[model samples]
Target chain A: MDRKELEAKIIELVAISYGKDEGEVTLETSFKNDLQGASVQMVALVSEIENELDAMIALQDASVCETVKDLVDAVEAEM
Target chain B: MNILDELFAKAKEDPQKVAFPEATNEKMMQAAYETGRDGYIVPVLVGDGPALKALAEERGYDPAVFTIVDVADEQYRDEVIAKYVALPDTRLKEKALARRMQDPLYYAMVMQKVGEADVTFAGIDNTTGDVLLAGQMIIGLKPGISTISSIGLCDIPGWNGSEGTLLAVGDSAVCTNPNAEQLASIAISACDTVHELLGWEPRCAMVCYSTLGSGAGELIDKVTEALKIANELRPDLAIDGEFQLDAAIVPAVAAKKVKRESKVAGRANVVIWPDLNVGNVAVKLIQQFGHADAYGPMLQGFNSIVCDCSRGAPVSEIKGNVVISAVRAAGQKK
Candidate 1:
């Protein structure tokens, strides 16, 4: 999946992932600080990313990640 | 011909160390009395000694052929309950108080708990709730187990059309709305149980509407979580899910639909259902409507003792439950 498509899919998962109202999450929105996504949600996101794009990003590496852009970059590198 | 015969054979080869519950009913009595050729002669724990003697006499059960423990006397009752509550593994007072509110089934569980018997089978006339309550109150679930269930061995006649396969379906009678994590735990536990009962290292499938993430919903989410956790728990276990039945069991369909290269797909011998309601209905339909013979939905994850039985089950079925429980106890000890 391309970056734009990938970003959109990530948002969809994030909204459900955080149980937030759709369209509320933005690219710069901090997953932990602003969205309240738990550790389980991050793991789930990593799995979803792997399945969707057939790539793996170290969940440990992702744990230190703070923004949606960080995830996109991780996905890009893994892709 | 079945694993049951093999297990009974094993039990007979070691009869004194062989501790099996006494046949409380005529059918079980007949099975136990007539159960020869299998190595072990099991000990029977009957509620009423005189009643059992009367029935044995009526049924022509050689009073010499079996050893029976009459648990009806008050002293015996207190002794049994005290022993059950005293076990390092059992929480005695809580269980005693809980079971004191009930009758015979609770008493029966205490007998098993105190090592008066190796495996205890009750509930021929009792409800699932009754059997389970006795187990939970007296025997309690194994240390980490948060729930209980029934996993039946269903042999669908014929293979490729004539030699049918045997499958294990679980939580058919227990665990409602199991979360993603619980579902994963159930799958792993069921796989172990399948190995113990059927003598096969089972391929597990977490059944869902979706095939390879094609279907989406809360149910899919649960199955997906189970898949991830199963990988983590038993990395070597062959398991997969979030698939339709066709893809889960049929090789051709699975090859076309399921994306993961999983050993479990199209070859799974164990099926984990989403909820007890669905599982109970599915297994029942397969047994009653499809003419498949089922043997459990046995309790798992309990501590030292196990208590389980069918609702108004025949004697043969109850005997099988005992054998399975004994085998499980033996398996856990290892």
Candidate 2:
């Protein structure tokens, strides 16, 4: 998928991970600022992305990803 | 001194308040009562205060010595819940936190989180999942901990290894199938656990079927990666591996098989399994055939000490774990 499509899918997964609405998540949503960088949510988000999108995102790579766009970038690179 | 005696002495040196949420279970209540009576910890039993006291009296325990409280007690419940919610870094959101606080397990967890209690001990009547979930939501994870895992001790009957008949194994009862990062976290946590509980400078070896790149597979790859990550994350720690069990602990095997200047190859006191499958089986083998006494499967990587006793465990075993956890809590206190 392209960048826009990948980002949209990641937003949905992030929303589910943080227990928020789909519209509430955005590309600029910072993990540290907004989500407190919870490792549990990061795990849920990565596993969901891998299962639903067939993209294997290593936690080490995703761990440094500060924003929704950063995570999307990591996933897309793997794809 | 033996490990148990040492732990008991250390625990009594500075007893922490351990909250038992399963107060209604006779085994749990009796164990808590006896533990408190012996002064290894200050026991806080959570449930209906009157019913807990009555049950303790019926069971021939001194109810006055134990502090019993109820999550449904509006004044105390509101106090702990409000304190926990006001903490700087809470894991759960507001609505979910409120809903979970209704359970005694979560309430006790919040008690520990807010510093009202030192350790939260349960899981006699609750599932391990329930206990872990409550811990994650209330107590939160230690900084840099990717996931919650467990560590245990095996006191083998008639043998002496580098650590003198005792070996620490981890993640046997939790984290079913861990990725490389999760595996590394388990090793790091186990290192900290053995250090705190047994006061040993941990020589943690990540044990798998492969010995220093001798084998190749996804499983072996995971262990090798975990070793690298663990070393990277905590370079000060003695974490090494991609060794077979024999190579990890046995000097002779390690000398022949491992061809590197590895710190944790032969004289390793702690062994971290790749996943729960290997960990669970390894513990059973040690217990049944090796005739070793297993001390834990004690949960680690949380901000505070947490444990989930086997539902089938007898009161004696539970009391031992309580002492063990209390000692760890005491040592881990910063």
Candidate 3:
């Protein structure tokens, strides 16, 4: 996936994880500091992303994500 | 100590702290009465208070010890009805508002919702869907859970001639067929549950028909994809798969036969089956032929405290499931 698509997926994932309305998330948003994703939610989101992209992304990797950009970049690197 | 033994000992030591004889069923009442008499948890019976009292008296038991919530013949129905109607989104309120329903399970859910009890166990005669629907409407899912699935605890004596072995199998009663993502999610949930329930750090095996990269098909693809996703989602979690059952759990068998050098080989306590058909049938075979003691199809991922009990569940199973639900709810409490 391209950067834009990856970023969009990250936003959609973050929104879904926190049960917030879509489009509320931005590329600059922090998953832990701003989005408040719990351990289970983080696990679920990574599961969704990996399925959508046909790749694996671990919970520990997702936990260190500070911004949507960082998440997109990390997922891109794995891809 | 074995978790089951510990639980039973706890049940024996402090009977008054637990709730029992939840409803007025003949068998449930009998078990609850006995459990209460043994000092497990306080027995709070829900139904017609006078009728319950009369029944207890007819059965030659003292009714004074059990607290009865008289909804049928008393104004407690309103109190019960109000509890369900207040649920964020449920038909129980509409049923009560229209005066078209009178069921104690809804009241039971409400009781659990309002903290009147620690847990509620039914399904003696109710279908799995019936119990699930009540829980979905009243207790709801825990925040962000997508679906609630069941797990079968399979134990095989001297597995491969060892002392004994335990396996947690899933989606036996809930999902019809799960996708790759669903499979991964179920495995993760099972891992969390096994860790908390059995005190076993989970080594998850995503099982397929073929071992390693030799298999090629949608089935194999699904398992591989699920394993990939599950691995990415919980990196610290000890999970690896796309292997046959032997490759997943038996290290000696895996090393000589399978190609991968997976850490999960032969030591996996959690087995994620391909689909519901495989999952359900495997668990049943293990329980029947393998003589494994199956504890639950305990529903997870829902908001409230709803659990599905087998149609042929004995009183002890009912009591055991109730304890499981109570512990689960207690963990979720704020």
DockQ of the two-chain complex in candidate 1: 0.01
Clashing pairs in 2: none
Where does model 3 exceed 4 Å of error? A1-79, B1-3, B11-22, B72-101, B160-164, B228-236, B256-263, B327-334
Give candidate 3's TM-score: 0.68
* Each model's Cα RMSD: 16.3, 8.3, 12.9
Against the hidden true structure, what lDDT does model 1 obtain? 0.65
Assess each prediction's global lDDT (C-alpha) against the native.
0.65, 0.85, 0.67
Predicted complexes: DockQ each: 0.01, 0.09, 0.02
Better of 1 and 3 by lDDT: 3
* Cα distance off (Å), candidate 2, residue B163: 1.1
Chain A TM-score across all models, in listed order = 0.83, 0.92, 0.87
**Candidate of highest TM-score:** 2
Winning candidate number (lDDT): 2
Model 1 chain B: weakest 10-residue lDDT segment is B13-22
Assess every candidate by TM-score: 0.67, 0.82, 0.68
Tens-digit lDDT track for model 2 on B126-146? Answer: 888678767776787888888
Evaluated at residue B290, the lDDT of candidate 1 is 68
For residues B258-283, write the lDDT of model 3, one tens digit per residue: 66566676777888888988987888
